[model samples]
Target: MPVQRRIFGRPIPAMSPRRMAVLLGTIAIFAVLTLVFTLPSSIPAGPSLGKFTDHKISLPKLKHIPSPSILNPFRQAAHAPPVQKNSTNGESSWYSNWNWLSPFSSSVTLDENRSLLPPLPDRPPIYTYYDHTIEKEQELKDAENAVLLTWRKAWWAQGFKPIILSPAEAMNNPLYTELQMKQLEAPMMTEMSKWLAWENMGTGMLCHYLTLPMGSNEDPLLTFLRHGEYPMLTRFDNLGSGLFAGSKADITAAVKKALANPELKAAKDFISAVPPETFEIDPKHDALAYYNDETVADKYPKIAGDIVGNGAKGLLVLNQLMISHLHGTWQNIFNRGIAVVKPHPDHMSYAVHPARRLAEFLAQCPESPMPSSCPPNRPKCKPCVASTPLKISTPPAYRNTSDLYTIGTVPHPYTMAVLTAFRDDISIPWIRRESPRDPWVTALTKELLGTGVSGAPRVIKFKEAVASQYGTAHSLWITAEGDMPDDLDWHFGFAIPRNATDNGRSETPVPGPERRPPVEHDFKDGPVPTEAELEKEKALLKRAKEFGEARTADEEKIRGAIEAWNLADTEAWKFARAFLARSSVERKKWEEEEKKYAGGAGAERGKSEGWGRWFDD
Candidate 1:
């Protein structure tokens, strides 16, 4: 009989030893199978188990580890341990051994030499300001765009960030607004406001967009960053306000100092106190005269010295001339290399004053010698016969003197000086026939003359020729009783010069007895003139006298306009000369430095393109 155990008070029955042993064996096998299947599920899913696969550990071996026993076989699967949670608490537990299964696991070995991914360097900002208020014309807008474009490209190419702000952006600051409010009252304030606006904006670098040329390979901003100790870094040592670079703190401090200057304040006060009507006559007249006054300079020696020493006056002149719209004035300034056109040569001399040199030349050569040959005195011959009668016409009168004043004005003492110098020392001499025969005038006359017939046909031909030579026909066309000829071929019997061939002979051949061959005549001192020829010569001389008188009148008008313009800039011109004289040593040193760096890393890379030619021209 088998004894069985009973719950509560029930009788117990006992079974055979063989049956009990078999039952225990079956229970052990069930537990073993459960462990075998459930062990894998305990390990994390979706992890590379290849590293652990080659090891001696096996599933059967893992079954030896302790696990919760299955009290009911049916519920054993449901009660399996939860899958190992990721180490979200940022810590490892006893189960950390299994962390190798995760790619993000800290336990996994990684390449130690791999970079941590460094951040990019900060690029220095270059600030350029434009005043759109005044630049209304398309030509002005185009010019401004061209200049700004160059600045943008150059700065970008050199690893800098250029920020172009307009008057609107500048006016956002209260300080800029305050300065601008006074510009109408005091025109000089217009320029001063620009400086204030630049300072108000956070600092890194500053320059006029119109004035900055293309940069060289050597990074000037980088150099300043690395070695600069001063609060401000000017292009020349305290020479000009055109360029500056520094930290915000330093720039702010320096600008504040300049703004708070006592002399500057006094000058401003003096100018502002003047009656409003004074400016109405000539807006810049009072201001110009005040700055240029010897007594005022004596009273404000410090400011005067500072202005001259720092080259502010000189730079002011350049800025004024740039916006002046004066014909050839801008071109002359550029050609003279007054601004940063290109580096000056080592041998270049600045000792002699340009004005003085020109004056000396004028004194030595008062007038050009007249040509040796003259028209002979002969009896009047038959008047030159024109195939068709041509009409006489009056040319349009020159622009009024008042109209000239509206072209431009120079308010700065230094600007006035430069313009006066340009007009007297350069412009006047350049055009005056008595001074020298300008190659341009010579070439023009050679091209237009000697092709037309005598009398009115010749006169009409001259007008036509001038119209063709210049840009506008309206300006050159004679204001005649009848309509001016629009036909391109109206020049009666006049031949246009043909292009030269490879051998330097005219492409157009002369119509003559070619088979017989043309004879080259040497008439240098040959036969007496025929009566008809003398008549033609007399007619030509009379026509020439009329042309000369017209030309002289035109020249006089041009001279008067130029003189007015020069007078407007006289004070500025004088100051600039004095400034130059005072800063000769510094100027020499600057030029030497320029020469040293001209072709080195500091030299401009490509030739400045675009409207830079407006300056370079």
Candidate 2:
């Protein structure tokens, strides 16, 4: 009998080591066979299997593989479809079959042939009008060129095709002629003619008036297209004419509707009712005056009420009526959705700065020949002698000369400094100094600042020199205190506040008004100044300070006069600051919303809280 051994509490027969090894080997072989039968026999052939069986292996097919209770107790045993290689793309079809493992399986689909994304739609044409009639003035032509070229380049960069409709293009339409005729009766019809041109030229287009400069970032037109489908879209909540988009048919219908509206007749009647002398003398100023008169509101209640509702009393009654009618027409035509969006604070601003206007004049008339109206002995005339002043006219006599030194017989250092500063200090939108070494800048400087004694004589000579050399309808002579001649076109002085410091002396010049930060003001319209602009403004103020010092030292009687003179421009500067501040706030809000939307929070909150709804009325 085998020797018995006590193991734990049980008695077992003790065997030799060879017998124990044989027993363990048999159990291992049995387990291998069990695992082979349990696994699915559909596994693809691979290098691992080749190592074991020389690239060939055969296993008996099992009727069923039991689901392991520990791994997946609730899973039922089933045969999975065999994976196949996609012959076209040479990729395995495992992802399509085992989609449950993929996170994006629901949102995206993979196929052998093509992507499922729809192709992007073509962008609508952008239509902007340039009335060549104004090109009669070389300055106007240069200014227009600068603005249009900038506008075209910006739109082109954003994948838009900008079409600058000329007066000739507008003339192609029969309706444009009729609109032009109506302009004789109503001057505001000029804008209507431009709209007609846009409608006639394209099936669908965006109309952005040239005066409103485009921003470098964010394509507002593209954004409008993505979220809006109305027949018409306006830039402001009040249907401002500055920027808008529509289908040709919709624009035509809207224009007709506006023309036919009874309120148009009322608007015309209100304008006709104003005293002819006042209205004809200064239509813009006097028309606004008449509209603002409390008695006039009572007389033209319907039109006046509409203007009031528009929220800007500064506009001409006819212009306001046009906006009101267009808005009403859009609502009538497309009953669903708002036709107007709140204006972007950073874009679509009117280019109304005096600096911009001055630049335009300088650009056009960099070097003008001595006016024919100047006395033949003018160049040799005594500095203090008063004679009939030269009659400087629009489109100043231009001479084709590149020689900067030949601009004037004598050098005027003070004038050269001022003009150089002016040319270098251009910070307006859509305007650029083509060259730092522009010969015209030097020429204009010499022409404006005459070679003479300093003080009252210098002022008289300076005024005469400007009158003779650079007189245009838009020409302005900025001065301190003195009664300007009736013939000379002039304004008060630089739009600098009295309390403002001479930024030239300070290392860190303040960019806002003394009493308040620019951001605190409630401006209705203005572009947010870029960092480059602020820097340019600082440089300008510094130059201005230097100018004031020179002038003060040369003319003792007018000491501290520059500050008092600058006070005249305070209101305009205040408006500018307010606009800058308002634009900054709007831009900040816009950027914050953009960040929130891009970060996926927009989806969780829904469209109501997104920037899209910000445009909604």
Candidate 3:
């Protein structure tokens, strides 16, 4: 309150002259600094609103950008300079007056000092190897060597690599077709039997006769007889068509040629002494014809005689029907006839036979050649035997009595019967159908070998063959029964000796009379049968036995009746053989008589004059 000054109608104190001068100087200095710093920043050429404004202000207007030309920089016209029409040369020029204006353009100068390149040569063929003809000759020679080796192996009964048929070949194969036809019901049953045979043979059993197509080149019969050892012949002639045309010399020559191969030198013994009796079927008759004819025995010697003559020690005629069809060949060979045994209808079809038991025994005693002596201390495996051996003129069963003192005793050569527990009829369409559960030999073998026996027929056969002493017998006699069905399950059985002495017998003690062993049945996957069930099974077996006996009796009667017919056949055959033996002599005599009659001209004149001319008159 010293002095009050009015600023805007209010009283206030006034400042001194010095203070006023200071305030004025401060305001002037601030104004000068703002003008110097802000003038340049406020110019419209470049302006920025960074950190200065407080009041609203108008923004500066922006100028419009110029429209650019649409011409493409990469255009053909842009890449090269225009041609100078007034110049002497017609070539284009690269130099331009304004080329430096473009930042993307190169600074290097372009020149027209280029020349054309030479043309390329023509292309050669893609493939050109012309030595196949020479290579084929080498391949053929290699094949010959392989064949020679295989032939020697087969001769040794070492088995052979089976001929694998192509899909096309299999479909047309006659043997395969027959197999299909025969096993249509149990389509895989035959295969199962074959596997069993193969297994048995491999383990300890004797060599088996495998059914093969007649014309197959790979057949063991043919392999030994004709083509396998003959490298020069690419293909063998079919049997019976003209098998006898070639002489023994030709066979010897083939053997010699085969031995010439260095690879086969070690096999000379096999080639040189290949048993002449290796071929069982006579080459004079067609195989199909001989198999079908029942009178073959009557026309020739008995089938057993033929077998023995061909060096067979023992013959197992399993298909009794087939043998019976040949009149009395079964009785003549084995001294007994087999009757068919029908299986229970409700029972699942399976294979059970003495042969299977023999196979099992063989599998168990793989190292032992004689199944009876296996394990040494085990009960001597007793086998079924015929009451007496047949007295044949051909040859007696070979005997090897030296081993009797060493290995206890050996039984006389005998043929045991192996009966199947299945229905023989498969001709009916309904019976032929099968399911996946039905056992297939190949599939069963793979499954059993891989995972052990799962109750498959193959496994069962192996087990049975191992458990039984049936192999102790010389051969097996398999029987079939009932209405001889055409589609029978693998009805034939044969066992071939691996060595020349297969029929040889030791001086072993003779087997006692036939006696039934106590049955020791064990269940692998099911409970044992009740007393009633056991009784029922026994009754069923009794009925089956009675039926079998009745059938056997009937068969015996039929055989007796047929025996008379066989005698007639024998007489006829005897007459025919006797006539044939003197055919040449008779023909010579007839020719001589004709010549003598022609020479007698007086008799011819008398005959012409007497009745012939008079009767006509």
Residue range 81-192, candidate 3, lDDT tens digits: 4433221211212222322222111222222211111111111101000111122343443432232222222222212222211123223333344334433223233222
**Candidates' lDDT values, in order?**
0.31, 0.33, 0.25
Point out the higher-scoring one by TM-score: 2 or 3: 2
Scored by lDDT, model 2 comes in at 0.33
- Give per-residue CA lDDT, model 2, range 1-617, as digits (tens): 85677879799877789999999999999999988886667566566566667655678765553323324657554543333322112111222222221222211233321111111224346677656554245443443344444344334333344566655655677676555544334434545556567667755444443222222112343445434354543333221233455566666665655455444434443223223221112111110111223532554454555444443332233332322222222122222211111112231111112222222212221111111111111222221111221111121112222111011111112222233344433332212233222222222333344433223232233222322222211123322111112211111111111112112122122223343323211122334555565455445544544554454443433322322232212211221222223223333343355333212111111112222111111
RMSD of 1: 37.6
**Going through the candidates in order, what is the number of backbone clashes in each?**
20, 0, 16
lDDT of 1 at 300: 35
Best by lDDT: 2
Steric clash count of candidate 2: 0
lDDT of 1 by residue, 440-462 (tens): 11222233444232222322332
Instruction: Pick out the ten consecutive residues of candidate 2 with the lowest summed lDDT.
Output: 487-496
The alpha-carbon RMSD values of the candidates against the true structure, listed in the order shown, are 37.6, 29.9, 38.9
